[model samples]
Structures are given as structure tokens and as C-alpha cells.
Target: MSAFFPALTAGADPGRTAVRCGADTLTYEGLARAAGALADRIAGAERVAVWATSGAHTVVAVVAALLAGVPAVPLNPRTGERELAHVLGDSTPSAVLAGPADALPAGLDGVPRIDVDLAPAGAGPVRTVPDAVRTGPGPVLLPAEPDDPEVPALVVYTSGTTGPPKGVVLSRRAVAASLDALAGAWSWTADDVLVHALPLFHVHGLVLGVLGPLRRGGELRHLGAFSVEGVTRELGAGGGTMLFGVPTMYHRLADALAGDPALAGALAGARLLVSGSAALPVHDHERITAATGRTVVERYGMTETLMNTSVLPDSGPRPGTVGVPLAGVGLRLVDDDGSVLGAYDGETVGEVQVRGPNLFSGYLGRPEATAAAFDGDWFRTGDMAVRDPDGAVRLVGRRATDLIKSGGYKIGAGEIENALLDHPGVREAAVTGEPDPDLGERIVAWVVPVDPGSPPTDAELAAHVAESLAPHKRPRVVRHLDALPRNDMGKILKKALPGAG
Candidate 1:
């Protein structure tokens, strides 16, 4: 039996709810039987793709693929034709598992289609794994011998910022390690019931939000779509103990808190509130915390590294930081000269590098890219950050986009964005570096003003940022916009900004 989900084999109540999406609810027994039955159908397949919708079908299909020891690649429902074609051509899965009613794009027409059945299991106690689908004991530690198979469990693709999205191969061991580490950090247990409305295509929503609960024998309540009303109903009903969301969701919540008392009350009742995929602006963080007395914790990770650092539930929230390295993960910062920085002064910014069992094995069919991604055992994250004396990490920005070397001083765009967000005139802000004859790279601020008709002047906004942060960190140029371009996960697409490379 696979050891990833112990709730099934732990002799727990069969009728306990495992996953709930809107009106659809699946008990532990039901999920086990459904997944095990489907696992039997594709036991020997090398790889499979799942049309990742925000629904129970996605959860069940992914669980089944993991049970059968086949790598599952989650395809975003909104992927464009060219990118979709690239992913399909790159991964080359034999079949595509999708919900019964999902209208898969023509790009997937060539692959054999397998409709995941979401029917309830027969009335009886269920075995977690049927004999036909059992894949050994499941998910061993890393550093497996060369002779070991080390089959990957998932092939999550990166957001094609640099090029066509590369398939990141995540082994079962890596997934299990990540979940276990998070369980320890958050004091997560079977008693907790999680609530979220995040899409199932990414690691934050699928791996940690869905699989994390299953690993800990907890319950998951997924909102089909993100709404403050949904959050209130789920968390206020006395069922949900935790909530997970991205900065965009939290930002909306912060905005609604002033008018919606129910939302504030519900958020206050939750035990843990987590934000990931991008940094939560300090302005929004302060607003939410002040209204609900619940500080939202932030965690840092990517497709290649499942999770590296997170703010523990017990630790008081640091508004701008993503806490410390998770258990079993080694985190360090390296300067431009490739020297590891020994200071935790929180001023010197360096490239964040991490080594841990929770990391993906490699990018599928891209050995050269994989080799370039690693410096020895440590994965070169390409994220720039600084460490506090207490070991908390504050991510400045991505190496390719966020770090701005201007006038002989290196700057991170996040602090400037946060400073701009602090201004009442600014509604949304994104910072980038553009080529400059004098500063090498000039700091540029793309802002969405609170009032479009009468926006703050560039000089005024620049002074606001300079007063809030530092003169050098202030935006050299400010561009007003209707909105910032964002991905499904609500991360700002900096490369899409004007004048960006």
C-alpha cells in the first residue's frame, strides 16, 4: 500500500469527510475505493496528464495516478494553444485523465482520454489499496541507489517565463517529505479541516492544499471559485480550521473586511491563514491583521522545490517575511561572487539556494537545463533574498526580474512595491528594472491608482516611496495602469510589463 495517505490505512472512521467541493463531498472510504479502482485501470502507464480543474475529479485523478505509481502532469485549463501544444509535445503522456464533463481542447485530441468517475463507493468498509494497484510500500527517502527505479510521481511544468515551460519531475519521496515538513511546521493533524478556493493546477493548491490534508488524515473543503462569501460560509460554519490563498485573494479579503463583518469574523475564527505563490503586500497584511486579529502566514517555494521556508503557526507573523527553513531543508544565500554570505543582517541581498529531500529530481527530457539548475546538491533557486538574525527569509524578487542594481547599490523591487502599496493613492503596484545609461538598471514602478480619473502625480508617488523606504530604493519612473498582468496564481508577470526584456 502507498504510505502517502495514511488516513485510509490508519483505521480511521470510513464516513469521515476527506474532500468537499461545493455540494460534492467524498468520505475517506469513498475516495479510497474510487482512487484504487481507477489506479487499477492505468497501473503500468509511464505518464498521464490530468485536466486540472478546481473540482473533486482532479483530486481523485491525481490521487489515482499517485496510487498506481505513474507520473501525473497537471495541465492548466486556461493554457493557450501554442503553450499547450508545447507541454503536450514535451511531456508526451500516453493518456489524459479529465472530469466527465470537461471539454478538453483539440490539442489533447490525439491522446487517449480517460474520464475519472466521481461516483460514490458501495456501502461497506473499504481497503485503502486493492491488491491490483498496490505499488510497494511507497515514498522512500532521497539519495536512492543508482539501481533504484526512482520513478517520478508528478511532472509539474514551470510558468514559461524564460521559454516554453519545462516539465519539473517530482518524485513521491519529494512530495511526502514536503508534506511531512509542513505538517511539523504548522502543527497540522487529522483534527484540522482546511479550506481554500485555489486552482488545482499548481503546487500550492494541489500538493500542499489537497495532498497535505490527505497525508495528515485531515479534511479539505475546496471552493469551486474564490469568493469572500464562500470563505465566510465555510470557515464560519465551525468546520474549517485553516484557510489557504494567494495574495490576490487576501488582498480582496482585506478590501472586503471593512464592509463585511461576516468575512472578518470568519477569518478570525480560523486557526491558520496561509498565503503563497507571491508575497502578500505589507499594506494588505497590516489591514487584514488589524481587522481580524489573524496574521496571514507566508511561505516561499516554486515548482521545482515544493516548499523551502514557511512561518510556523506558533511564531508570530512577520508581515514581510516567509519565516525560516523547513525541517530537513538547508537554505543559504550566495552573493554575486558565488560566496555564501555569513551575515544575517537582513541588508545584504543574495541569491537564495536550497538543498532538501523535498526538491524535484530534475526537469523531464531537459538534462542540460536540469544540470544548469543545480550547483552541486543545492538547487540554484534564482530567487534573491535576505536572512534576518532569527533566520527568517524576506524574498526581494526573482534574479532575472526583481533585483535592480542602480547607482552602485543593489535593490530588491519588493520593498519598493510594498512602499508604494503603503500610499493611499496606490491600489496595485509592480516593480521592475529597465536598462539605464547611468544606473545600469533603473527601478520602474507600474501602478494601478485608487482613482483613475485623478491619479497621484509621479513626483508625489516617488516622494511617498522615498519617505517610506529609501531614496535609492524609490522608483526612478512610475507608470500608471489599469491593472497588473497576473498568472492563475496571482503572481505579477513582470516580463509582460512594458520595457521588460
Candidate 2:
């Protein structure tokens, strides 16, 4: 098989910027030299760990691991101690690659640290690997021998909702296939300079944000932190062509666009604006489109399966729908009784099961979980969705929490949440199902109001929801909060909400 990054060795424009974070920049030549040297040091390792900070060092370390043909485990930098300990114990990486300045947590005390060096070729001295951990041959600026496509590339851990986080082993082919499919979907090209401030540990930020640009031979400008001002500066100055963001980021931009013409102009100038990690609220999407005339393209995927479906750039914006399946991916909707649904009437809800080259190998060391995740060849996604006649996938909610079986109706929490968001008094909303004596499950709305002192009452909110949607879909109970709990990627943590019990 050919190399994952053909530009690194194919004598592309060496002077072009490959990756950058603030003042730190790495040209293709510099990246090849630095990552190549680091790859040589970790060549023989069974698995390596990357302290995935939102910086250039983390990118270099992961690229080095891939070049060395070693599977890399990306650990979130801000992970709590107990969870971090669990991940460290579960993955059992031989060495943890980190920036010299990063203060690693005590959970990783026993693991040997490999300091990633990003200094220019002649810029003073650089950090070297400890003699005890350096078992590979001398440094060489070349790809490792035997470019096997089946070799594991990354071991990304999933969020442990039910239990401890399981390691998802993504192979080299999966990563390449995902990026290539997304490229086709988005009309991505080397001329497109992608900009985002997504967290590096997750697939959205690391694999798609970082690796996608590399695979396309394009530039990546990562904001160390996300801010509307920073985003405006990058795109406004004509440096960035593509923008990748989650809903929260777009929500903030939508809120700010009214007063910031520069921000609006910058967004309007971008070739593509993509949103993932979570669904962008229709209110925010509409506000953004109204302000900048750019509809944010939303794509759907999970940790186990990479890029599965994306709204094609030419298809126009169809709010609330994640577009058709990508190339080489086989997707189907299965009913509760485990029978396949053939009709695409856009009303029937079913679990999404996908089989494709984009899927991960399995959960690392957990055959039971790996086995349970799949039914025959298709991987059961646990996500519930409906398909339009044109084959667009509209996710209603997750089967575990988002799907509310109440009064003999299968309602997706997302639509309820979207309806609640449309109300001017509501700022943030999360819909969930609570057990009820009368109804099988009661739809509960947890909301952060625009004005806490004069928040909307339960009756008013319920009436509002009933006005927009069906009467049965209205929230039976409404809980007001100052704010909603969210993960690093800006996804609302429904289980963490107060009164979740």
C-alpha cells in the first residue's frame, strides 16, 4: 500500500506550511525531519501513548508513531485521575510522548516519557529520548518498512458512559479511507487551509482536523483555544479557506455575528464550514446562515466508525439531517426486533448499523464488547435515526438516553431539544425521558433560560413545544438551570444534568 501521507515523501512543496499553532509553525520539510527522527526512536514499541494537547507537538508525535508503523493511544490531557489511571492501565502503552513543558499527571508516573522535539533544524538544542526507552535503530528520515494497511494506527478510547472507557483500535486503512471519503464529500483539496480549535484527543479534532489536512496536502492552523475573535482573525486575513467547528463554537459565532461585521465577512469568505461532534441547533444554523450566507455542513460518525455520512456541499443545506452515506460504506436501519427496514419514508426509526472499511478493528482486549458491538458484519451503532426518501439520515437520539418511548410514541429527544431552543426565552436545552407511572416515559426538558430571574414556566414551555410539535411531544416537566453541563467537544452531557435520577 502507498503511504498515508504521500506529500511527506513525494517531494511536494517543502516550503508550504504543514501545521501551525499561534506563532509555532512547521513546514513540510521540517515536519518530515522532526517526525522522521522521532519515528526512528519509537519504531519497535508495541503501542505508544500521545499526550494529545492542542498543539503542534501532539501532531508531530502522532505522525511519528504512524510513520514508525506503531499504534498510538491518544490520552486526553485534562482527563481526571481515576479515569486517566483506568485508561493508562487499560492501554498499557510502552512510553508516553509529551511536550517538554507539559506537567504529566501522577497517573502516568510509571510510564517513561518521550519529549517531542519541535525546534527547527538549527534552532539551539533539542530533547532526546532516554537511553532506556530507545531500542529502535538510528534515526532516518524515511517511512518504516512494510507499509501494511491492516496495521493498527490509533487506539482512541471511547467515553465510558456505561462503564470504563474501552479502547477503539482504528487501523491505518480505516483512517485513510475516512479522510479520503470526507475529501470527496467536502470537495477538499490541497489549496484549502483548514482552521479549527477542536480538542486533539477526539476523532473530530485529531484524525479529521489534523490528519485530514495532511492527507490532502493542505495546511492546518489550530487555535490553541477556541474564540470567535481568533477565528475571525484567521479567516478574515485570507489565511484560512475552510473552517471546522462543533455546534457550541458555531452557536457562539451565531450570537456574535450580529455585532461583528468582520466575523460575518470572514465566515462568508470561507469555502466550507463543517460542524460535527454534536448537532448544531437549527436556531444557530439559521442565524449563522442569515448572517453570513454560509450553511454549516454537518457530518455523522462515531469513535468506532469514522466518517460515515456527510451532507454533500452541492446538496444545499437540509437542516436536521446528516446527509447520505459515503463511498465504500454500507449503512442500514434495523428495527427493534432485529429486522432490516427497507422503506425510506422518513418516519420509521431504527438503530443505525454500518459495515465498511472506515470501521475500527475492535475494542482492544475486550472480545466480549467487540463481539457485542457487531451483529454478523454490520456494527450496531446504538444510534436511532430515520432515513428520507432521498437517503438522508436524520438522527433522532441515542437508543440509551435520547430515544424516549412514551405513550406508545418513539420521540427523538433532539427534535424536542430543537423545539425548546427555538423559544426566545431558552438559551440551552436538553430533553430526556424520565420514568412515569401514567406514561411509559415522560419527556423532561432541562433548560438554561435567557433570563434566570424571569424564566419561562413549565406550562408556558410545554405549550410552546406543543404549538411547534405534536401535543404528545410536549415536555411534561421543565427544569430551569443557569447552565448545562458539556463535554470538551461541547456536547451536552445529559446524564450529568441535575435531577437525572
Candidate 3:
């Protein structure tokens, strides 16, 4: 009864496409019937593990688990065997729902498997259950939904500083609040068709991308993969208005815009273009806007915090900022000494702390780690940020990797990285701090040169940084790499960089 979507589909056209992924598609009626059927099969299960993939089966499996009122633990399909096993041991799921378990990944052996039969969309008759829900005879009648707001809905596993990925338990209430707030922020509705090619394991893809549209009774067209052809094909096929992507996808889009007129026009025609997971470089933002006349809105979020801030759809783009704290989300900056700052002059940097309904209930099994993550009720996000007087929050970088202390001046690595990126010789850049006897921590620049045959020197990069930012913040050490190592979400793996402090 506390679910967000069942009632949303009421009075709406059941024949409408709820999800369309490649050749596979599902109507609203089909989604309800399929989910209700699977829900009945796993009625009393406490937890279910979904082998998250970009397919109709994975989407249906997750929806079925939610309908059954069970906490769903989404497993990253590409995760290593050891990491996958740790997740299974920590969050013992009653069943693992997947398309085909034939080539089962390592660590999933001996686990109960519920094969999700993905019927072609719109093929089956929508049979009605007793609770005004349409269900097929595939699994039987679903259990009556109980009105429990605090019920654990999702156990999204995120990697810990040490050991395996720690599961973050997000309650039903939290999910509901987050989706509703986002709807208001983005002017989302059922009439709009959302387009995205993001992965289904992380929150950006699963929680928001998959579930958000369903909750609002909107049509979603997933590209299955990110490609310029896919984006143009989907968006160009009328009614695809909203698009979601990370910085990498946007960067590719921006890079190709000059040569592709159809792509630029299709992007310009979109109602909204959103970028998240990592900061989109200012250069890319400016290039896309210059070509397409459409600015990509950036939002900030994490596995632990579903969504914190977003640049509104109507708000003109601010190159480097991720806008203000979303509705019902409280944000503050905490200095290194643990004192909360009162004013935002846009210069002082502090660790961002947030308290809101969107936050997770706790880290599963590790209660001490959960307690340590929060200061009272406010979650201490290790990201360093500087808020403008107008309430826009600009991320500096991670406290662990980007905050460099040198020459009695606390410097942020993101600004230096951006400055280095502005140089024509630099193809890619990441900034970190290495300990030095004179400066305590000297600023170091990791650069991917545009031309390896004639690369920029450490002195040239140092002068570039000095011209762009404060002289003290200039990089004293420059190391060139062929390319920067990035994670699945397109975030630079700072720890993976050599000589990181």
C-alpha cells in the first residue's frame, strides 16, 4: 500500500509503452501483469538478488521484488568473483533472479535461481488479480501489499574503503521521497518519454533511471548502450524528450557535435539533457551549448545518498556547479576542524554534510561503519565543496585525494585539473597531492598529452596552472600518462593513479 507506482498507473492508459529497450519492449499493462506474477512466486522472501543488466528481464525482476515488498540487492554483472561472493555472504538473499544462469558468474553457485522469462512486450493478455492489479498465471497471485514506510526496499552495495562492497539499505519511504522530489525538480510527468543508456546496477540507472519513470507513469526508451547512433535514433524518433548520461557520454556528444548536424539538432530538440555521476568538464559544457543551444543540467548523487542536488531544468547552466540542495534536502559545509560554516563566500572549502529523507537507513551489517558515516543524523559526505552565496554548490574534489595543503594554503585539485584541461596541449587531466618536506603536500598533475611526440613539460604545465589559478596552487610535479583510468561511472580512479597521497 505504501508503494509509489501501483496507484500511479491507475486511470492511465495500460497500452502505453512503459519501457522500450532495443527490440524488447513492455507496456504498462504487461509490466503490472509480469511483476504481479513474479511477486507471488517469492512472497515470503526477505531479500532477492538481481543480476542487474540492461535488459527487460532485469527491469521486470527488480519491479517484481519491489511489488513483493522485499529488499532487492542489485548485483553488478561485471564485478569480480571475490567481490560478488562478498556481497552474497553479507546480504544473504533468498533467491537470485536472472535471465539465464547457465554461465553463472563465480560465487553464485548453489544459490537458488529464479529464471526470469522475458516474454516479448505486448504479447500476453493482462489478467487481473484480486487487488485491482493485472497479473499473468506465470507465478500465481501476488501477496497483499502492507502499508509499511520503513520497510527496506533496496540494499545497494557500494565498495568500502577496505574489504568488500558494503550494502546501503534504503527504505521505502526514502525512495518514495526521492522520486517525488526529483519529479518536482525536473518537471517530470507521465507524458514525457525518458531516454538513457546508463547501467542498471547503480542508483543513477536503476533507482532513478528505471524506477523514476515508472513511478510517474512515464514512457521510458532505454538505448541498451550509449552510442551517438543510438542517441540520435531514439531522440529523433519523436516523443523522446528527456535524456540522461554521465560526463563521459556528454563529452563524446560534445566532441561529435561539430561534425554531426543531426545529432546536434536532436539534442537541441530535447526538453532536458542531464549529466551526473561525475562533473562534466566546463569545456564540454560550453562546446555543446555553443553547437546545440541546449545546456546539459548536472546533478550530484551517490549510492549512499540517492540524490542531493540538481540544476533545475529551467535554470541556465552554471559551468562548474551542481546547483543547490534539492527540496527537503539540508546541506552544510563542515571545516576540517569540524566547525560548520555559516556563510558562503564561494571561497572556503569544507566537507559536504547532508540530512534528508533521501539518505539510506544504514550500511547493512556494519552498524559501526554506519554510525561513523553520520554526525548525529547528518551524513558526512567526504566530498569537498564550496557553496556560492546564491546557494549553488560547487564540488572541489574528494577530501582524500583532491584537497591538497601546500605553502600554508589549502588548495582544491579540481580547479587545477580544470585549468590544465583548458590548455590545448592537454588531452586529459587528473590532479592529486603527494607529500613534500617543504610544502607538507605538493600539488601534482597527471596529464595525458594531446601529442605524445611533443608533450608539454612540467615547467610549462606549472606556468599554465600559475596563470589560471593562484601561484601557490600551481603543480610542482607533472607526470604524463597515455590515458586516465576511470571506473564504470566515468569517474577518475584517483587511488589508482601512481604517487597519490
Residue-level lDDT of model 2, residues 1-501, one tens digit each, is 117877676457877899998878998777876787778778889999999999999999998898788899999988999999998899899999999999998889999999998852333222322231333334334554345788999999999988899999999999999999999888899999999999999999999999999989999999999999989988989479999999999999999999999999999999999999888899998999999998989999999999899999888877898999999999999999999998898888899999999999999999999999999999999999999999999998999989999999998998899999999999999999999988999999999999999999999999999999889999999988889999999988999998684
Clashing residue pairs in candidate 3 (N, C-alpha, C atoms within 3 angstroms) = none
Error of 1 at 345 (Å): 0.9
| C-alpha-based local distance difference test score of model 2 | 0.89
lDDT, each prediction: 0.87, 0.89, 0.84
Q: Once model 1 is optimally superposed onto the true structure by TM-score, how far is the C-alpha of residue 112 displaced, in angstroms? A: 0.7
**Stretches of candidate 3 exceeding 4 Å from the true structure:** 7-10, 120-143
Global local distance difference test of model 1: 0.87
Candidate 3 structure lDDT: 0.84
For model 3, residues 437-476, the per-residue Cα lDDT tens digits are: 9889888899999999999989989998898887898998
Query: Ranking by lDDT, best first?
Result: 2, 1, 3
Q: Best-fitting candidate, measured by lDDT?
A: 2
Sum up the clashes in candidate 1. Answer: 0
Per the 3 Å backbone cut-off, how many clashing residue pairs does candidate 3 have?
0
